[model samples]
Target: MSEKIEPTAAIEGAAPGAALSPAAQRALEEAAARRKAATAAPAPAEKGGPSGPEPTRYGDWERKGRAVDF
Candidate 1:
């Protein structure tokens, strides 16, 4: 009968490097910069301003003339 072999024996090629390639590194850096900029930028004011009346919870229901009263 054949015996079980070590898992590593199944692998036949050299291991891949842990480091990112130059172009990949640049792309990763750019993505990180864009993410940082997006989060750092001030959020745009809501359409009617910060103090505008709160939006209805069920805008679609209101449009359909449906209401649930407790």
Candidate 2:
């Protein structure tokens, strides 16, 4: 029986079920790990600027600013 071929040139070294060569497998695993870590969470927004107030459950009605009627 013959081995099935993979589509990716990068992973061409790895077959469907066959174990990858040590160096190739390690590189692939490391790259995968890094990608996972990078996409794990969104970067935190910077704080302490007038960009906008953080959302609050309480309405801003407490402010004394003149109301604009539609």
Candidate 3:
């Protein structure tokens, strides 16, 4: 079996400034900014406000507001 590789190892190996063309570098920077913004945003308030009842954890067989049991 092949050894498992950490996801970030490939990212760390790249030199971002060395080979990217100007347009490619700009695109990369834009993507990074969007990623940062998404993570920094607050979690959305749940339905029915802060005092709402906790949502139910539906079973696997539930779909389209229906439940099926084998």
Pick the TM-score winner.
3
Model 3 residue runs over 4 Å out of place are 1-18, 49-70
Whole-model Cα lDDT of every candidate shown, in order: 0.48, 0.56, 0.53
Cand. 2 Cα-lDDT: 0.56
Candidate 3: residue 37 lDDT (0-100): 94
Clashing pairs in 3: none
Candidate 2 — worst ten consecutive residues by lDDT sum? Answer: 54-63
> Could you give candidate 3's per-residue lDDT for residues 1-70 as a string of tens digits?
2544222322323463355444555666677778889999999866743244332343346554666565
Better of 1 and 2 by lDDT: 2
Candidate 2 Cα deviation (angstroms), residue 39: 0.3
Q: How do the residues 1-70 of candidate 2 rate in per-residue lDDT, one tens digit apiece?
A: 2554334344433555665555666787688778889999799978753355633324443323644232
lDDT of 2 at 16: 56
Distance (Å) between predicted and true CA of 30, model 2?
0.9
Q: Which candidate comes out best when scored by lDDT?
A: 2
Alpha-carbon RMSD of each model = 13.3, 9.7, 11.3
**Residue 35 deviation, candidate 1, in Å?**
0.3
Q: Considering lDDT, where higher is better, how would the candidates rank from best to worst?
A: 2, 3, 1
